[model samples]
Target: MLAPTVGAEAAEAVAGEEAWSVHMQNTNVLQGHTKIRSPYYGTNSLSQAPQMRQTVSLDLLLGLRLWSGAEAHLDGMMWEGFGMSNALGMAGFPNGEAFRKGTASPNENISRAFIRQSIGFGSEMEDSPSSSLFLKGRQHVSRLTFTLGRFGAKDIFDSNAYANDARTQFMNWSLMANGAWDYPADSLGFTTGGAAELYLHDWVLRYGFFQVPTVSNGISLDPHIWKAWAQVVELERKHKIGSHPGAVRFLVYANRANMGSFQQTLNNPLRPADITDSRNYRIKYGICLNADQEIATGVGIFTRLGWSDGRSEPWSFTDVDSSASFGISAKGTAWDRPNDTLAIACIVNSISKVHAAFLRQGGTGILVGDGRLSYGAEKIIETYYDFAVRGWLHVAFDYQFAVNPAYNRDRGPVHIFGARLHWEF
Candidate 1:
């Protein structure tokens, strides 16, 4: 009778532990900025002179363990405010937190809702702690993960530890993501997708398919997944240098949609030829290489190189045909403040010869076009320092300088300054 009672108590404890697997997270970010010393005003330039703009966003992330090796997650978000010139004028825009469409009033949207299942194939086990969208538990090191539902392709592809998150890291669009990959997304940067990942001891492979927006950079996504879709694959390898850790990833993506051809637009003799008039089932593809390495106790380095076929209009992401960026980040442990961080990076963005001619002929892209073109590579340098106020709160100061804004040499050497406040729990 005593042995049976002890067994029953152990079973009850295990059940209670399983029931506590549900978790919730909340994050809020407030960012404000002003661009100073603007360049010559072109018809399509971002607003000249010093103008102040601000944006605020809040996210509620929730996760629940549904069954063995399965979990469900959801995110509710509220966003408001505007970027400089309503997020226009620059290909490598300065504020990553600001949406392209800014509203005077706050708006709510469902950013992510998804289900994930993991299947183990080997006996190796690992402890996975609760972080971001994942729930806390023990997981198999060699396993297969399947995810389905609405999310950003960037959530699973082109990931970099030092340069991924905009709220806490770099503020430029090109620095946050590979500018030339052109991964599919709506105006708000979310889409319905499904992904599968295979994890092994030293490497992982991931593949994803996602829906594209109905129109070019439109807010509404196309429901016809078969007609308009994007696919991506990534291979990642983890290694150690001495006693430090590092990772490298190679990603390639292809997008098929009703997009216009740049050369076709230029050939049309119609007065003020438009790229949109030639829309058809066209394809765009790109590749990216990303790496991150921990050099010292709290110092790390990251870099990315990307390229895309420049014939098609940029369906999503930015307007660059080629890009390269590298940066270094270090924690404040040297000063006995372990939570603080400082980082600096530089990105050079360029377009193809045909792409340059399109802009020179008064054609506009999704993010760029200055009516006329004095073409030069868009070069940008950005840096930021983040100071942690508490375990969940951080304040950061950021700065960026861009030459040849929007690939137009006649336009700008713009200077931007910003501040960000972020809280997560």
Candidate 2:
């Protein structure tokens, strides 16, 4: 949905110009779940349960044009809130110290203040805050976009694409693309910190500088904290096969950092890894294909494939290893009733080791896994319906099922039923 824009409040070099945008969504959900201790410790049993959740968000932006080919912006999230476990999946311990410290809350306060410029002859200046500079020339395409300060690492294809709603809490699992989900405990894998994006033709590359993971520091010396792990850098490419109905995207990415290495340099101030030795690096490569064809009246199909390796050789950790997951997604409007849309999707996740070493008792992140090696992988299936009530409002119903022997031990599956209402303009 596009937010409406109005004329500037002042004409002085476009200064003092401001605009506001808001997004609100709410959802009610019911869920059933069960969990077993471990494969060798429990019998196959299922427990019945139900749950509820709510979410709200708001964004405000202000822009000012400094000179030709240059502009500045202040965009911030004014109101961000989430309640309950509407089945977004846990990114971290939902009730951990981070939450108690207010560092991690259902309600988030995030913003970015940045500027942009175009430096070249024949360059066209566009009012874009996200892209530092974008240039298009005959037979050539290049964009140098850098986002400093703070901003979201979200994209259309993978980042919270399906599960972000004001009425429903953002499903954390939906935030990850193929490579980001390989190891859940690796905090340096993907971060929403200062990052840059460079695009050339069908390819887009990105990298970020963020905080180190798995460290505890005293409050007085918190600002002295330094990063222990390597910064994250990734590359993505999307290309059209031909005029035919097909397109493909490939990704190659790597990041190195010390996960648990932290020490106090002075006065109990936390200092990240200063190791002269080689830092542990985890890398991934993935390819996905998207195709579409109208077989009949308002009917279509979609599919995707993904795989990744979670292990980094020459490292201190030996638990998480290779993992492969794939899914097929299809959505088509009913033949007779073109106004009604039906969508279905299923994704399966597999880990190389039986139990995930990353989420063990001694490990970090969300501990949904059993202490024993997972004898098998986990699976999730989701189906949803989207019906357009108007141009700006939509009503949707969704159902999801997640099954993992390691996390739920003997618990068979967790099922969630949800209802959503969305209004974006």
Candidate 3:
């Protein structure tokens, strides 16, 4: 609930047609796991014992219309708690809310402070509805939009309506974004960057450049922007399939950072070949294809396929060099509950031969590091049901089954269960 002062400020913004607006939301998620089989464990391995974990987050969004076609926004966030196994082991982590830097107590920070400018090119206009960060207004259909400041790479790329937001949709990290893109970010999953988008009729083009962490999966970003940076470009098309709407996006990304090569790490016999020990300003590249379609009145299907250069170690994302994920979501209108949702998805993740060899030699990456390697592609199946308790509250039950977790055949076929509660106003 909003305090009286905040409520009054919101009312004034609406009533006076003021340029400034404020919105806030909170989400608390509780996820638990049932024990599975595991003969041994490593430093980054998931525990075979049953465990439960919870995370809580709060976000306050403030937006100000600086001038015609320009806006400034800020996001203040507070996060707390950890994920199962401290968010390690799996190439596709189970909980999207779990951050590598999670703490038992709450931590506050400014997640985003940015400026957006839109330059219209065509006379055609469209309505832009109000959301968590965008203000309600109308804008030209053909325009060039630029955003600058601190934010998340996922905030502007690889978006799927049926399977994007973890707070309201799928909970798995692989389902939330293309795992092989390795988009740049710190431990908390955000970075300082800039993005530009060109909108045309039925098509859009996007490009972004962002900062990378100082080290692989590290918490601090590199200060020397010229020495380390990540770039991404995407082309998106909107189409109709038999009177149903659909969209497809093709994306490519490159990162130039102080990173190590998989083969180089393995070939160095003088020392225990570790990726982290041999950092140099090298480049890594990847591509992703994402698509979504509405097949029926209340059903939608989405898929993502991604691949990265197998030679280099994963810098900012997971350990997967190749990935494919597909899912379907349906509304519960048939059961007289229009606001409820049901979804299921399957994901397959694999590393390169060199990466497998490195792991076989007991080399560790960001997430997976079994003592020894029994290489196999990691596969997962996930399902969830979300029930809307009221206008502003929702509850969800989720389950996941994994085969060859962390790409190790010796480990498990594991089962995981979760529950989530979310509220926004």
Candidate with top lDDT is 3
lDDT tens digits by residue: candidate 3, 1-425: 01000111342244334477777777777877778678877777878888888888788888888988888888888889998888888888888888877899999888778898999987898876666666667789999999999888888888887877778888888888888989888887889999999999899999999999998898789998998999999999999999889999999999999999888887788444578767799999999999999999889999999999988888887888999999999999999999999999999999899999988888888889887889999999999999999967889999999898899998887888898887776
Give the TM-score ranking, best first.
Answer: 3, 1, 2
What are the root-mean-square deviations of the candidates from the true structure over C-alphas?
7.0, 9.0, 3.4
**TM-score for each model:** 0.92, 0.59, 0.95
Instruction: Record all residue pairs in model 3 with backbone atoms less than 3 Å apart, i.e. clashing.
Output: none
Give the C-alpha lDDT of model 1: 0.80
Q: What's the CA error at residue 49 for candidate 1, in Å?
A: 1.6
Residues 34-82 of candidate 2 have per-residue lDDT tens digits of 3422233211112233444433334445555555445555544432223
Q: How do the candidates rank by lDDT, highest first?
A: 3, 1, 2
Largest TM-score belongs to which candidate? 3
lDDT scores of the candidates, listed in order: 0.80, 0.35, 0.85
Clashing pairs in 1: none
